[model samples]
Target: MAPLASDPLGLAIDTTFDDTSVAILRGKREVLANLTLSQFKDHEEFGGVVPERASRKHLEAIQPLLAQALTRAGVGFGELDYVAVSTVPGLLGSILVGLTVAKSLAYLLARPLIGINHIEAHPYANVLAHGELPFPALHLVAAGGHTLLIHQTGHFQWSIVGRSVDDAAGECVDKVAKMFGHAMPGGPAVDRLALTHAPAAHRFPRPMLNDPGLDFSFSGLKTAVLYYRRDHGGDLEEGPVLSAFFDAVIEVLIVKTLRAARRFRPKAVTVSGGLAASQKLRAAFEAAAAEAGLRLLYPPPELCTDNAAMVACLAAHRYAAGRFDDLTLDGRPNLLD
Candidate 1:
């Protein structure tokens, strides 16, 4: 099927976790308002997102964000070509806000409602921005709730080729950052500090890297960093020993992603989700892609984390392909395919 051209507009509503972002896309480009949570930035002080707190924040933000998106798009609710929302693999409470809101809008407007998977939304975000996604692609979704390796054979067609056994890459980063007294969304904090530490200063196990399967396990690496910090007090030459701990995590992440790229031999490989925002992960993936002669794609830094643009983008694709979900669709907190 042909992709959407520049003429038709696709409206997307994303309620993933605490942040609710809304946008209108003219083809692959965002042509409307985009809003994010200031609350999440505040919540980071506590080290992680609290479900109830996030749910409350979403309830407050969703209405305003949607109103602004409609205004910015210069269209009324009935004018939307398609209504899309992330329906699976996110906080159930948070997902409910978007689903109900989208359902109400779609029902009232008589437009099709598209349900999108939060993880699938991440990789499709790049496709929307780039105009095309090379087939048989590998997407490493390294985020808070999930660390999955996805195989995308076509639009809206994907399967989890592999995944983490324990502790997502983002979770590991957050917990490790907490060990060093860094801010929340520990991936970036760890990445920033890791720049000053030696990548080879200490060797942490790669955790299933040597295994023949494509699965990943970061729990061991998380514990390794914890023990390293506990034993050495996070001390390095000019900073806390936690600096070295960050370096180890980056190395393992890079190595594992690269190994996946080589083994899968996909047309393109995408590193997405919150950890995709990490400078360390981006640089490492770019280098690995170049060395292995594989295509690598990522969203803009802001789009890397949870946002409606990715959700909207995925929704657009599914909508265009005649994929729709009814009110029977419920939010899956731990929803898997």
Candidate 2:
């Protein structure tokens, strides 16, 4: 639907890593247009994103994507009420490209600028797609670079209760897939292979499952896969190996997340981020949340990955709160405590 003439429009830009994207939101609830330029093919030969290459690609794609998003939304630059951009916890060079472009647009248009936390924005993507989420929600942000279990008590208020101590879940998937000679951005490939293959008789260890706290560790599991390949003469069937690996990873994520859900008794359980698009992972979460009698929410598969829509969705709230940032804002590559 077209945005009403009176509806306020917000623009969002994100290039924290490989995905260069732009989006427009009408008020807080309606998405006018969301465009993303993926760099997966560029990084396929490298088996993962190359920071320098990613930044360069973002620089080239950001302006074009932004124009396309605005055109598709049927909104002009002067019509935008706010500009939001993801500015942290990502590749430094990549983050700077989007942040710089966003700052320039906000300045030229004299619009309010809002800086978004990439991780925080992921959960809000659900809010944008659906309506307001049930408060006190347990959110799992599982992506290539991060795996966090966050508890949201109110708008813009979050507490991270669990995090990956080593390789994030998505990273583990990629590494394992690379070991098996799978393509880059290997999570989806591994997931698909796992679905077709039966689990091997051997099982990988579930790290930190018995621990009494809410933290995650996948390095050991990744290593186990590596050693398994070596011991099996590096000729193990990909299907069974991937199936066992996928089961191990999914089990840990489900168990730890459910433990947190039960302990906190959140009204809803939300999962977002690129890996959240995994059909297998979503199924496991769906089953567990159902058993726990908690509502489960996730964005559409498109929103599950890195995109500007989540940034804009989050900006809508911050804008209403009168939160704005000045031109001095800079990219932060580390997570905020």
Candidate 3:
């Protein structure tokens, strides 16, 4: 079929954190453009992401990125059928930046506006990668900000079975990487180092694994690493220490998620979020799924991080379900609330 001006389009904006990302999609999974501008360098010197700086960068980068997405997708505003934004589970100011722009566009273009939960939209990344999510599925979301295990019975019908009681898995990874003197967003660095090295002789404790529940706690694992480095810095290399730390986190995640899958009897299991980018974790999951005789899925590394394509894909479902939001929709900074 020939492309037509009348073809409907969807636009997604994501400013949930330090990155400003815009995505354009035709229908659901057909992503045309996903332009993201990373602002990690601006906050890297601060040792962590500064919320105010993240918000300012979003305001500056969003318009240009939106323009680039539209141009790259070869679609104008007139073709837009809906506008979507990651509106919650983020810094208030940063989420507001994207939501305001989305609302204004919705009003001007008379298109439907969909406010997506950043944490919830993560599973949609898998949906974008693999069409039609299997019902009665288990979803482990290990993004930097949130870690939740969702039991999904259908679209928009899911309940959290487990969540981080303290530090998120991705946050633990970043802090562990910073111990090796890497920058703030150091999960990638840790992943690279972990790949090159074997697990350390020092075995870190897997937190909450024996608690008879699905909840997780990585703060203890992180503190164990701190104590190990302080007490025996000369005893181990960074590569091995990092490997052991990551393995601790992965064990807790995998064990708890698999436990939930067995209890819930889900048809398949899915992993999403920033930590899902880890090849080691993916390999471990692949082996576990193979052994357990269960189906497993995850988005590619690019989709694992903060991006609007997931938001857009989730919004496409909402649009089809008539789940449009009015201009009065406001930002909710608290992800759980």
Q: What lDDT is obtained when candidate 2 is compared to the true structure? A: 0.86
Return the TM-score for each candidate structure. Answer: 0.87, 0.91, 0.92
Question: Alpha carbon lDDT of residue 158, candidate 2?
Answer: 93
Give the whole-model CA lDDT for all candidates, comma-separated. 0.72, 0.86, 0.86
Q: What are the clash counts of all predictions, listed in order?
A: 4, 0, 0
lDDT of 3 by residue, 1-337 (tens): 1222233579999888878889998888899998777623454433343434343488777776777688789989888889999888778898898999999999998788899988888999998899988889999999977889999998888899999999999998899888878998889888888899998888899999899999999888888888888888676689988988888888899999999989998888999999999999999989998899889999999999989999999988888777878899888888776
Report the C-alpha lDDT of model 1 over 1-337, residue by residue, as the tens digit.
2344335567777776756778787665554655565533554432343324454467766666676567767888766777888777777787898889888888887777788878788886676557678888988888767888888888878888888888787888788777667778667767776666655456676788678777778889878866765676534332334455555555666666677777767898887888888876688778877987888898777777777777777776666667777756677777565
Worst 10 residues of 1 by lDDT: 44-53
Native-structure RMSD, model 3: 4.8
lDDT of 2 by residue, 76-128 (tens): 99889989999988888989988999899989988888999988999988988
Query: Positional deviation of 33 in candidate 1, in angstroms?
Result: 2.5
Local error of candidate 1 at 232, Å?
Answer: 1.9
Error of 3 at 106 (Å): 0.6
TM-score order, best first, reads 3, 2, 1
Cα lDDT for residue 166, candidate 1: 82
